[model samples]
Target: MLKKSLISVLCLSLLVPAVSLAETATHAVKPLTAHQERMKTCNADAKGKKGEERKAFMKSCLKGESAAAVKKAPEAKKHEKKTAKKPKTYKKLNSQQMRMKTCNVEAKGKKGAERKAFMKSCLSNK
Candidate 1:
């Protein structure tokens, strides 16, 4: 009975890994969603663009806008340049950056070891 149980346990251990691998393999190649397909097509079309032009092209293409319209967008932008607003004023900051900024502002008057201790405490509290 001991021999038979040990043999069965080994077989189960071997089969467990095989079954898990098969399950993972089956899930690895899922079909893309409709929106993913659209994005794929738009990305391919906008492959040559860079910076804000690429962003604008991707936005328009994903929104079901005609590629022709987006292609001629540069000319329209030329005319609108006079009325176009300035670039964004505030930058997007992550939590760590915001914490650092606040810490720096608070530690403005301090120097050397004092500033280091203040920053260390401030960073940890946040």
Candidate 2:
């Protein structure tokens, strides 16, 4: 009887990890809401814009902002303070590669093309 009980205990111990893993794997993954899905289409490239253009684009793309929202905003002078920081330098690339990278970054797609394009833009723009 003792041997049988020991075998049962060992079997239960072996099952514990599997049981926990199964439980963890069963969690429901909620899908994105409509608003979130819409926001995802907003140009990730918009981060590259600034000033009135940025405001205009964001306002139009995100829908109009309220008066109260504008009132809480910081003054324009504070926003316009430009430092004479030296421009970034980039490693020189051959023309063909540069074009490929440029096209890739700006092209709409998931994964490799998007990443390559973003990198190309960043590197070439530097």
**If scored against the real structure, what TM-score would every candidate get?**
0.48, 0.28
lDDT of 2: 0.64
User: How high is the lDDT of residue 81 in model 1?
Assistant: 88
Error of 1 at 115 (Å): 36
Q: Please list the Cα RMSD from the true structure of every candidate, rounded to 1 decimal place.
A: 12.4, 20.3
Name the TM-score of candidate 1: 0.48
Badly placed stretches (over 4 Å) of model 1 are: 1-13, 74-126
lDDT value for model 1? 0.90
lDDT scores of the candidates, listed in order = 0.90, 0.64
| Candidate 2 per-residue lDDT over residues 27-103, each given as its tens digit | 64667787676466545635766786556555556654554443334344345456345679998999877776676
Q: Where does candidate 2 stray beyond 4 Å?
A: 32-72, 76-126
Most lDDT-accurate candidate: 1
